[model samples]
Target chain A: MSNRDRIEVLFWGIGGQGLVLASIILAEAVGVYEGKNVVQSQAYTAIVRGGTSKANVIVSEEKEILFPQVLSPDILVAFSQEAYNANKGKLKPDTKIIYDSDMVKIEDNVPFKLYGIPFFKIAREELGIPFAGNVVALGAFSAVTGIVKLSSLERALLSKVREEYHEINRKALERGFELAEKLN
Target chain B: MSKNVRLMQGNEALVEAAIMAGVRFFAGYPITPSSEIAEGFSKKLPRVGGKFIQMEDEIASMAATIGASIAGVKSVTATSGPGFSLKQENLGFGIMAEVPCLVVNVQRMGPSTGRPTKPSQGDIMQTRWGTHGDHPIVVLYPTTVPEVFKYTIEAINISERLRTPVIFLMDETLGHMREKVLLPEPDEIKVVNRKFPKVGKEDYLPYKPADDDVPVIAPFGKGYRYHITGLHHNYKGYPTTQPEEVEELTKRLLRKVERVLDDIFILNTYMYDDAEYVLYAYGITARIAKEAVNILREEGLKIGLLNPITIWPFHEDKIEGLLGGKKKVFVVELNSGQMKGEIERIYPRKDVIGINKLNAELINPYEIADHVREGLR
Candidate 1:
């Protein structure tokens, strides 16, 4: 399992939670910054907010990658309980599952590692940014997977984020990384 | 020297390729799975002093492109499932009027707006039959992102040279998947513009075919004062209901595409020298079918693949000859048995089977492998 050459990741959340933004940042980091081949794809119905949304990103260091969806995700980042339930079946034996503890309750006897971070709580309380939770999850993913370097991730964020929200979201990412390192 | 290859989605590559092909006018409506083409053109066209218009609907979008093409501008329109359905009447109009333009359909799952943002190769037959008429059409299917760029350039050239509307038949997977593509510099590619008639205004007959069966097309505003209409017309471009003239005009319309059939037909065959079984596939499903056949070959089954690039005016005889002594031919597609019927019609004596899916997802290579294995059993 460890011999895998690509880090397949899926980000699941409701609309307006920056699900697509997070995946785009990761794809740009891996593809443009780290010089890895990447594909970032999103799924949604025709409607807009509060709808079920998913962003699938594949980062491969070697070999050409096709098909954007990760049949078995190495890392699953979920923001809501429904998001976690929707993608639980896509985890591999050694997969890593990360969800917001404030929003989702985990089931036991899973075949993979699990980490519950209070992503929403950290963003709203510590950072005073209500919607930066997705960026915080990106930080946590960088800390655990290490497939994407923090510098590359920051560069991607800085390039895409608007000037008004850049500083606060940057702080949120730092806090998520710091908290992620202390988790078992 | 070969330049550095930049990764591009099929939509992005199509835009860049169109610009390089000297396409100056684009009219389209934005729809999922194909909106990027309009966006790419909208952004870059202004930089190059070209034009892109977001029309109110697909019919007007397609019509505007044809109008631009007739006025001596290279033009194109892009759309997906429902939009493709809407543009059919105008597409037939382009056919009857002998208008040269390109129409690209980035296929999504659908009978009617089925899945807006999902990938499906369900538009194969639509490209051929969407328009209601006996008109001849050229449809090219690209399997990979880079080919999307390559075939798009080819589609425009064919439209201009053949003086007919050409379809760049792509699907949601290739339309959305980004990959490395080496965009050709302006000097490295061949671009074809419609052949303008040098004949004086009095002697020029608009529909007269050249020795090669491709008619010399004169731009409407280029002092080539001639009438054009959807009703059957003679070489003088005037509508006529006479039986003899109608017979000649219809034969010429069909023969124009048939004469260049060899030049337009394209397919890729793998391991078919003496294989017992052949898999016929196209668009995205064909890529997975290739993988499935490769695995089956290793597992000691004699299997091969025939992937078509020129979908319409299909190289039927090539397929018929290949399946000459084969035990079975499996046609794989994302829709339920669309291209399989074409395959069966071509190879009447061979046992034909269809492995199809309508789930708005691409059929996996493993699923194709399972089907091939069962067929062997």
Candidate 2:
């Protein structure tokens, strides 16, 4: 859909990567805290772990979200090489492309603003939690695009999981922000 | 909308609203996409002093819902396509017996089991005619999580007030998608219980019509003994081969809701006040059609959309008045022209066209915009 007025973000990976959870955090960050209209739509098959899953979050300042699916996302985060390749076509010329440097092998000639960040590596090494990689990517994502306040994303992220992981998640998020700042 | 905001799935919204609307008993078979509703009730019902039962199969679930309702409690049952099919026989029984209960069907793409996680509007006709014979049914199709919350209450209220079964239809996308909703306290709204016979047990005729064409049948176990049967029954609740009583029972069963269609029907129209063409859609398809309307509006095309939240007994005259001068009514659905035929039944046959997709994927707005552009040319 041609939702040029709204900010659309797509996070895609295998089924068990917490991509849907990341999108939910982003949606609540914008919709609840920031007081904007937002919708998060997901597509998945029957597969539990390896199947393809994509979550799209669309934010609007004025209009209610009628179309939730993101066909052309302004910010596309691919956590796997397969996801990146499958969704790279028909992107906006100025679309921000963020891919996991650890998992995605990319060609040199890409059209959009591309950033290859090893989100998984940073989360695993800095926080000793590989599963927290999605939160780190959200941190880097907030730093790069300012689609939502880092504090808003942090609050939304904390509410989604148990109490024990919050501290490591905070550090992981801060590390992602610090790393992205240095590169940009 | 209260300040008590929470993020929940569409199925959870329905369950919560059903409870708030005084649905105290649930009998259901859990299935994909719709399992969350059954799970929610299994957890929440006991806290409200309600009952939740997981039936052996869908048919038993349907029968148990009707049974629970007969015992003077508001009851509900939820399922998917396969379970919905299994529930059809008792659904007719509910219609025949004038039982008041809610049936939540979170439709997945299907002939049989089909794609468990994929969404579809394929059950549009099946829901209307799933039960055999001439039966009147009310179906509510809600497009969003919050809408599901609002309509679930309406469905229960309708069912109890009219003494008929109301079908709540949601697709897989709407069933699984999570969104923030402002929940109102149950005390803010007046919850209704079905009317009971005020006369002595000996004076009450089980199937006799009250002033509203609905029988003020007392619930079972209240000493107002009544027989509920699937066979065509007379006012005394006894089966009869007499043609007059059979015809009278059949007509009154339908007449209760048929006479009040305008009061109960809910149609949502957007950008249609000055439009020259209309898009007809519901469920998630209507959501995308609204986006297509925006796109077409930006291009200076005079197009709009009509989404009916009330899905059964299509109100042709009301819709015809709204689409009086429109060039065409595009029936956008995730099926092959079920509702297109329904709309065509209103206008001249060729004035309506079906914009359908059956790939088990949602139809995109750009595809709809392109089709409108082509149709106009």
**Best-fitting candidate, scored by lDDT:** 2
Model 1 chain A — which ten-residue stretch has the worst lDDT?
Answer: A62-71
DockQ of 2: 0.51
Worst 10 residues of 1 chain B by lDDT: B1-10
Give all candidates' CA lDDT scores.
Answer: 0.83, 0.87
Cα misplacement distance, residue B332 of candidate 2 (Å): 1.3
For residues B307-329, could you state the per-residue lDDT of candidate 2 as single tens digits?
99999868878987887878888
Give me the runs in candidate 2 sitting further than 4 Å from their true place. Answer: A1-3, B1-3
Error of 1 at A116 (Å): 3.5
TM-score for the A-chain in each candidate structure: 0.93, 0.93
Worst 10 residues of 2 chain B by lDDT: B1-10
Candidate 2 CAPRI assessment class: medium
